[model samples]
Target: MVAYKSKVVERIRLPSRERRAAALEEAGYNAFNLAADDVFVDLLTDSGTGAMSDDQWAALFRGDEAYAGSSSFDQLTSAVADVMGFERLVPTHQGRGAENVLYGALLSEGDVALNNTHFDTTRAHVSNQGAEPVDCPIAGAHDPETDEPFKGNFSLERARAVVDEVGAERVPLVIQTVTNNSTAGQPVSVENTRRVRAFADEIDATFVIDACRFAENAYFVTRREDEFADATVADAAREQLGYADALVMSGKKDGLVNVGGFVATDDGALFERCKQRAILYEGFPTYGGMAGRDVAAMAVGLREAVEESYITDRIEQVRELGAMLEAVGLPVYEPVGGHAVYIDAGATFPDIPADEFPGQALVCELYREGGVRGVELGSFAFPETDRPELVRLAVPRRTYHREHFDHVAETAEAVLEKRHEVAGLEIVSNPAVPELRHFTASLEPVSAERAAAADGGSE
Candidate 1:
């Protein structure tokens, strides 16, 4: 039971989209110099990209002084290898360039990607590269009970079957850790990691890890599993990383700095292959398109990223907020993972069809009432949303405080109470329909000025 005293209220409600932009600053949310401070607690819409020190930000801006590809990048990439326990680690652009590099050799059309769950970008990258995604999270990885600290779902049998059907050459496997955001903050077990590695060897297929939530996953393993009671966060992380050939990371998630991401591999051949593409977009292997301090900060953050205290505190806070919502009879993701609390809009507002994109409307409601911001999990983050939509309230890397969580929760409860009053919208048409294929329409909130005008000069 998360206690909410009426004494604590939101600093203020950002009623208009334009004015909402000023809420953080107006509410004193911008006092922190670090971006991480802005995200980890804030339900604001940030992709956990980076949280750098003031000095690091200054260094990244001096792009001209940046060594395009420094030995420092190689050192950093090697550090990633050491942390992940892979023989090779490749750094690549997060954009189309990386996909192009993947096409001719590493990936093939009609091939399949088996992961615990999918992120829109990963799915888009894979599908566009000519493969479909297959997520095999441990049964109930998303459920509250019986799931392991590390929910390992890639059974040897499942791995073999996938490889047998797709051909080892075409079937690649991925394991996403921490909050299987798509599956609601489910953690994958380390033992499962060991097993999957064995399975990959058994089937002669490559294994990849989507490590966006790696730090949170490590924290869970240490806390929930008795077997790892003595393990440090870094040890658990290294243990899990050792199981895969390569891993993709979003700098926003684990990297301490902002605006960057990396791909790491253990295979020398694979490293060489991805290197060619890195130059096209991410720059040389040594620099990896990251500025000196950004890399320097990551080197520091990576060390800090595995700190048990930081990881535990961050995840526990999310669960606390989740418990609050669950107490209110609202549908939330069963398990709590780092950085988010998922609202099961479909269950909370069943009258709206899953395909109707109710998440779009709910987003508008939350934003209007409390200025609580979050992204839509339905069509917004996936291919289609409507019948069973999920609204993801992300607490980015560093964004809020204890009061902020309660503030967001209280606002959520208010919206739920009044959800019935919200009018449904009709889609007129989509312009960028191709890209829009996976995009759920932005509910497109009105600007403060526009909304005020519509309200007819009301204060």
Candidate 2:
């Protein structure tokens, strides 16, 4: 890949080790609490963190900031139609906004929504609506050591079980998260999507594909799935999206923009309900919650995201980082998913248990070792639930280069070398944090006295 623009070098502010320790203590050991200026390499998230291309930047001029029926909204709708085979659109501020808008319309109290795997926000939104969000990912999804190409595929068996138990009327939606984020960004196969569609049809539930990383998932389908081995990225994306009754996308991801998301459907009645929710919760149908310029940029980004070259390079860059970590004997999630590299923190630090938050311990150590910021995607992210312990280093799109990843790999190695020294964290207080406690929860290192007492009691 070649650069379309000149490299803009910004100084990476590297704080001293002592300064990092002080910062960690002050922030209560939460990486999200750390200042961006203090981080040398920030891999906390990919959402709204990528650099926009020249075309997207130029589209900003086309924005028409009107209260209704803006030209930018038209551009977005046209792009969605052309790229995703959808007829209607309801724009939102981001992915979660789209989820809230869509779920708020379709779901009622005691309703059930099934997914291959529900990321934190989607699960929280479903819970907020008093609906149950059930995960039905295939067994392969949970095995980080298994190199399955389509680990993101839904478990049809479990899906059937849930449907049977809940009865079809109580089940309103079935979602497939492309490149399932909770399970290491793994790609879902076209065949699996077709099966999911059939199952959704049988139960009369809406089949919604979460299109956050749709392009990346398509690229993987082209490379891995034999049926679509010769298909273009756009064609593969159309095939996958074609099976869905509706789709919810985060423009921050595949859109390649700083902020935007949308829910699209071909069903006119469903579209109207989504629009009502969009207006009630977000904004007007046309502008929704995003700015006009952001709408225009998302239009450009949606098209750009499906380009063969761009999608290829993006997935390969993520693989390159995964390879680097594996070279150092790190327990990386196999097949090196689409958008990020997930480390098996539970395996890395076997001595630490889920309640103590091994993933958070490793996340803290990565920052202290070399100022590299990664997020914990495990028990901490899904507290009060039994989940695997993992650390996700989500690389932003076209933002960091080889050198940055090299530094990240080196930093990970440094932390691994001293893994025994890492200490678990405990929530300072139970004061009502959000359901997604990982975002704003304050934690401190488990005190030696407390640790000893717990160990003695266990013995």
Candidate 3:
């Protein structure tokens, strides 16, 4: 297959090894702490890290700077309605901001919010509101080697059981994270969404979608599901959205924008409530927390993201990288996800214990060896959940080319060759609040030997 032409037009210089080492120590061995100039390949996240297209850059110049009732907001609203099938739109700075507003409005003390799997911020928001976030992912999601097309799907039986246990009144929302971020970026099916919607209706629960990667999920549906084989990517996306009463999106992901998000719904009452909270937490209902320029770019991005050629190219790029790692006998999540490829860190480095943060150890080693930065999605990220320790390589949209991925694959192979030498990390300072410590927790090497192992055994 011929590859898509590379579009990168900018580059930055990487710092020296000494500088990189010092940065790591200062940041407590966290990749998020490393300076952008010190890294070569940064896969820390796809959020707000992608390169904007020529069209998006042009849109930025046409932005309306109005505090309220801007033309740019109108454009964004139309885009959301057309692309996502949502009748009402309330913008936010990002996905989490949308969650804070919507969940803050709907959830009460002791309410249960269920999902296939809650990403870090989603779970945090639910917990912050004194509500329980219950995960009901399909059985196949636990196994890295499983090839389930809809591995991110929530089990209907589990949802029913939860509803029965909690009673319909206590269950406020049932959310489905399309292309589940916590479970290897797996795509959920349209059929599964419909089932979940029906279940939600049965239990008098509100059906919401965490639709950060809705376009990618649509592409997967078109490719894998026979019923949607004849449908265009946009058609499949609309179908998926049709099942949800409301959705929260991080435009940073599928919208192909650097910054923007929204809470969109068809329910007028819920929309009013969410808009009220949006004004309190975010900005006005029209602008939410984003600038008029960001609104313009997101409008364009929403359209571009669902294009057949672009979606296909994006998924193919991720697949190519996954194949490279798997070819070299790396333990990656099977059937590579739409946005990232997950490395089974625990399986690869059996010598490192779970308590020692094996996934984070790999993250540090990758950066030290090749200046490549990735994130650990494991016990470190979700301490209470029984999730496998995984090192995620999230590809920024239109940021890197095939050669860049080739370099990343080679680096992983190099690190794995000496996997036995890799050591674990010990947290030095944790958050006093005890919520999402991986973001700000400070850690140190257990010993000098462990540090040396991460640094590729002395020079």
The TM-score, computed over Cα atoms with residue i paired to residue i, of candidate 1 is 0.79
lDDT of 2 by residue, 220-288 (tens): 999999999889999999999999998998999999999989999999999999998899888999998
**If the candidates were sorted by their TM-score against the true structure, best first, what order would they fall in?**
2, 3, 1
Query: What is candidate 1's lDDT per residue for 1-459, written digit by digit as tens?
Result: 321123222343334545544543342222111132222234643354334444444545543324565544654665576665665544443323333444334567787777666655666667676777665665545454443454434545555666677787666544444446666556777777787777667656677777766878888788877888899988988887777777777666676556456767767887787777767766766556655656655555566667666666667767887888787767876666666787877666665554455766676557656666566666544654211377777765544557777777787889889876654433443435333342433233334565445457444
Off by over 4 Å in 3: 1-8, 448-459
Give one clash count per candidate, in the order shown. 42, 0, 0
TM-score per candidate, chains pooled: 0.79, 0.97, 0.95
Best by lDDT: 2
Root-mean-square deviation of candidate 3: 3.6
Worst 10 residues of 3 by lDDT: 1-10
Worst 10 residues of 2 by lDDT: 1-10
Candidate 3 lDDT by residue in tens digits, 135-187: 99888797998778889888888878887897989998999999998989999
Model 3 lDDT, full chain set: 0.89
Q: lDDT for each of the candidates?
A: 0.60, 0.90, 0.89
| Candidate 2 runs further than 4 Å off | 2-7, 430-434, 457-459
Arranged by lDDT, best first? 2, 3, 1
What value of lDDT does candidate 1 attain over all alpha carbons?
A: 0.60
